[model samples]
Target: MKNNNSICFISFFFLFMFMLMNMVFMLYFLMNNMILVLEWEIISFNSMNIVFSILIDWMSLVFMMFVSLISSSVIFYSKSYMSSELNLNRFIMLVLLFVFSMMLLIISPNIISIFLGWDGLGLVSYCLVIYYQNIKSYNAGMLTVMSNRIGDVMLLMVIAWTMNYGSWNYVFYTELMKDDFSMEVISGLIILGAMTKSAQIPFSSWLPAAMAAPTPVSALVHSSTLVTAGVYLLIRFNNLLMSTDFILLLLLISGLTMFMAGISANYEYDLKKIIALSTLSQLGLMMSILSMGFKDLAFFHLLTHAMFKALLFMCAGMIIHMMNDNQDIRYMGGMSLYIPVTSLCMNISNLALCGIPFLAGFYSSDLILEMVSMSNMNMLIFFLYYFSTGLTMFYTMRMLMYLMVNEFNLMSVYCLYDEDFVMLKSMIMLLLMSVVSGSFLIWMIFSYPYMIYLPLNLKLMVIYVVIMGGLLGYLMSMMNLYSVNKFIMTYKLSNYLWLMWFMPSLSTYGLNYKFLNLGQNLMKNIDLGWSEFYSGQGMFFILKKYSIIFNIFQMNNFKIYLYSFVLWMLFLVMFMLMMI
Candidate 1:
């Protein structure tokens, strides 16, 4: 017990120190508007250079500060939450490692250190995800690792392509790439890397599937550090991404991802999975705004979302623990009456998630919507952005109603007591920050206020979406979509949307089916059918026959056996001599 307390305190103390330093760095950069770059040549040969470096600017400092703050809180929370586990120290160590990896990712400016951080995150995350040592955890870990490996391979490709610039320090060459025609392939590869990390479009299934991890890991990873890493990478590379047709492609992919995730969240039943889908949706929103050349806006939203989503996940974790590890909202109701504090925090996070007025989520999400509304985008992108926004609110309301308003459906009253102060303590900090982060980030990032002029109805478009989505969500949740006749009638359409257009299956089973079939064919025609016959069966048969023919002359007695062996040796020698 004492040792666990020490681990918790030591981890929190170090994180707090890093957080304070990040604040100082943020202040210094704000005052002077200077970027601090530290570099040393680590390897140089044959005109190739790989530099180890750190970039200390407003972006890195601010992001690192958030990472530290959240990690500190999560470590403190885990001391209580994971107290009974036999491997509590191991869990804390893994959490600390995850935080360190994220810091490495944030401060890295050169491709070498970036890849270092990148691979470290992938490896540590796989370990953390599979920490429970269950089948679900194992499968989730595999999906997470394999999905991220694509990004790692893409980063290697980018590293090779950067050889053209003579250095792997992209911080210096971003401007060059922006205007050079030669940098197109590099740009595409960078986008691919970003997509794989951010879980955009076809790469998104792993985000929701990662819910098999422990809730503290979910709060720390999906909510803040890991999922945002890709978006942050894009922000760093925003200089290179501007004015490219690839931006338009990003707009399309991100918008579709938002729509897809939002719709899927309404149909999702798992408590953590719903929130997981919401994270995917928010990631899409950030990517969409970034694609529109609003890098600061995306970063601001990323930070704010991280705050509330982490809090939200922490609260969900408390509930899941109270509910005996059942994550289905369908089995929960009237929890608000029993756990008022958690319910309040959960609802606040959900409302903020829904973009309610004056909350932390509002400051960034509202601006992004207005700016997107004013931009001269095509109808398709425009529709996707706003419609997905409505879908987001729709799912939020449905989840809220089911969780708080319906009858208490838990199987046992003993399942919950609603008095975990340790868990509540961690959530309270993020709760406060989630309420404050959006406005704080805006003031920090935006030096000049934008003059967003719009007509009355257009300005209130967000409100309209929220209102309509709430009403429809209430009715939709109340209606019996699972009734026998209704389900049969809407089977195909409901199933399609509910399963996220079958993307999980596409990502896992669909591709595996093809590969397995190919392997089966090879086993039949090549291995067992032909190669085995020629290499093993045929050779064994011939050798056995020759051995049998020779065995006919063997003797059972020891002297006879020795004499026969000697005679055979002499006969073979004489035959060789004659042939010669």
Candidate 2:
């Protein structure tokens, strides 16, 4: 094989291993496990040919296909996007490692292996993000590494508890399904780990921080590799997630994340960071759906999101490369005239991302929305979700409008339209698949025997809702009522409204200093309190002034030997008395 910097070899290698791994697991499942074929399992298995896990079923195969597809796209994107970058071989190696870990994560028969894959992906992603080793990249990498490690530690505790009380197979979180005291405590801890990895609510700070990497790395981790590891964990423990306590926590976190991230993305200027926030919203939506017992819908969204998001990121990368690393949409206008193909790919991707009709995003997002609307959450949750979806479309269309529709300021000209054909070709291929695959995937999901409870016919109506949402979003963008609008200073309203959602990020920033000062004050107070109580200039202190009598006497060698002999004699006498 010719060693090219921009080839798809590593991705292809991961895909091959993904297929092989699933095949091996499927054979094992059929050979040993009973074939009851739950309707849901059948639904999951029917989507893709490969099935791997403790029991190779429909769900496993579907996830396997997602990992393979997204990975392949990322690898193809990486080739041309990273052509001129240094350490090309090592980059591919890390990419291979990341894909392998995700594959291993999903296929592992037990929790231990899944966690191993989970941690592996985190490790590889951090390294890949900082491949350039600059200060900003290193800082982002370290932040992500620390957050992920905290989650890993929580997971390790869960595993330990499981092994101590439940079976070590850890295959299904089967132990968590039990009503034992220990299982109850341990299950909560496990969900904590999931929240961290999935970037749920409070743990989501690390995600936006991670956008300092190369665009391709952002595409991979934010889209398919690292952030979604939490979703994988949730599905793997579907049985546990069905429980009321865990479901509530998942719902709370997921809902908050959806609302929070949408607003944050609205405020963001860096193109990659906006995409990163969008991933957070998408993951939150998936997590919320999964918590509502719609695992299939969640997984479907995950698969589709990966396709569109990877395309969007890659398109952004192409444009960024042309514009000399300027990722701000403020400087990006008239790109549609210069790079029509890339612009179209990105436009279609944004449409899909906003769940606009017929594209990949619509099918998945509508399904999740439908499923969520059916849940018992209050009206506030419903409003949050609906508004968040609107925000999703709002920012996405804002990006598209800025890049493809707005007039270019030719004065600050830097780009000369040197598009990489290899990169363009790969993007075009994914663009086609991203548009067509959503419906096919929806069909595959509905075709399964187990999803009888789900109404496949609602897809059309769902598509209609998606279209309405996207149209509203587009009109708002055009009217200059939102971020992209030049005439309307929606800024004043956005400042207040958006801040309601974004206060968490602001508060977190402020709290960092407050917490540090509070800790120092707390320690100082404790020292003073302790000194007053234990070493005060009072009666106790006065007694301590003459406490030498309570201490052991200092003696020369001969006197010390005499003291030791006396202690031995007393011990021997005591032993003899006891024996007598």
Candidate 3:
């Protein structure tokens, strides 16, 4: 809560403080972090018992705590960001509903309960995405909603499949179904669903396009709630997936997704889009690790990434607000010299993102890297992880150079100040957590350290990649190696990566255009053209002709009656003559 916006800020802060306390209670409960399931029959009809259930353990508890924290922080930040807006209450309600759905998803082990939350998330996100009511928002909202609907359908399929096992609660049967052949089919569908929700590979266009939503929505969607839901689902079902070929497919798809996002981010200019891409990359990172059989590691990173990434989005929002809503980094420069506090927050979050020594991102990402280094992986997996890691640094550096080091590029007033205390007050808490959560989690989560042994150069491979990526990014941004004309020489290649391999266009317009054209042809040639005549107009004419023929054939006239009486009398006379 702040001095001016007591109602809005207090509501956010209360939930935040409540979750902070929940974290402490969770810590105390970790002494026996056992799985506990609570269920209640909600309705009974036609011999089917519909139930709602909650899964309580370290995973759900910690995830709920983080979701709560992020949602609260986003709402608090929105208080300042949306101060002049008239429909502020509506925005806050949507955010609360989003958090509630995410919580339902996090806690529910029952398939039906999970689906309820999953569908709620997709529907509410669609509303939030189209909140601006602009053409771009509408288009993006459609893309996002449709993309997620695929996952919803997949979940429904899984729910139906689960019926064969006699219950909607999947946790009860994940281990039992491990060796069952049907498990492969169920898990594959689940992976597909998760991939769509998490923005993996072919389903990735929506995440970046979803930047049409407000920045606070981005903070919640990208960081703690929406995207992570997919990875978390995978983590929960990871045991079932481990024995299936889908697990390897998940791993390969995830690695490529990470690499793809990282490359696209380096070529992007929009600030929120770049952050969204980073989010995509991190999600891929979580999925890859989870697929590789390190679920606890994946989960740890998921939590830590949520803290700093949310902070990073908040910082981006602050910058975009100050710079008259121009999110292009090319139009921003020398910001650190102007608004020092925000710049500091941005730098810290960026550093954390790059896997700096002891910040939040380092703990789990470092462990995952070291674990990957120690594992027996193919060249492709190894290359993808390290390459993705380095590109992360590359884009972060490039963005920093354009925003903070280059000369002032803004066309607005010269005065630069950080008087948005409400925003800063919300961001500073995350700033502290981003610095501390990694180390704290390390101590709390790991009872014993992992035994990672490697050769000297191999151990330092990540550092080398980070250094090379940084140097390359610096050269690309700071040096005059290519003029506009020179850069345009490779326009096709540049645009390919810059446009995320043209995924948005291909996924949105290419698919939609083809289907739409097909529908139009069918409507003209079949529905309204020949088929209409044959089915409707042609059949009407046939019925009309039959009715006229029946009317003429009718025996209602006097001539027809007299002819019938004469025939009957003639037959009787002929019979009497034959007898005589």
Off by over 4 Å in 1: 41-50, 480-488, 512-580
Backbone N/Cα/C clashes per model: 0, 5, 0
RMSD (Å) of each candidate, 1 decimal = 5.8, 10.1, 5.6
- Top candidate on lDDT is 3
lDDT of 2 by residue, 1-580 (tens): 2476434675566675775675565445544543322212223455442323354465666667666766766677777777776667777778878878887776566666677898898898788768878998886776677667767988888778776744445554465456667656666777788888887866777788788777877877877778888887777677765764778777877888898888777666678878888898998889888887887788888888888888888898988887777888777788988888788888889888877778888788876767565667788777777778878877887777777788774355464666788787667767886898799778766655433244665435444544555676567545643545642456776665444355435434564446657878877876566665666555487687667534435434567678889999999999999999
Worst 10 residues of 3 by lDDT: 1-10
Candidates in order, TM-scores: namely 0.88, 0.76, 0.89
What is the alpha-carbon lDDT for the whole of candidate 3? Answer: 0.89
User: What TM-score number comes out for model 2?
Assistant: 0.76
Which pairs of residues collide in candidate 3?
none
The best-first sequence of candidates by lDDT reads 3, 1, 2
Which scores better on lDDT, 1 or 3? 3
lDDT of 1 by residue, 486-577 (tens): 85788898899889889889988776446667989999998888887678887798889989866765635577678889999999999999
Runs with alpha carbons beyond 4 Å of true place in candidate 2: 6-55, 172-176, 410-412, 448-580
For candidate 3, write residues 346-459 as lDDT tens digits.
999999999989899888888899999999999999999999999999999999999999988878565566659889988998999899999988887787778899999989
Best model per TM-score:
3
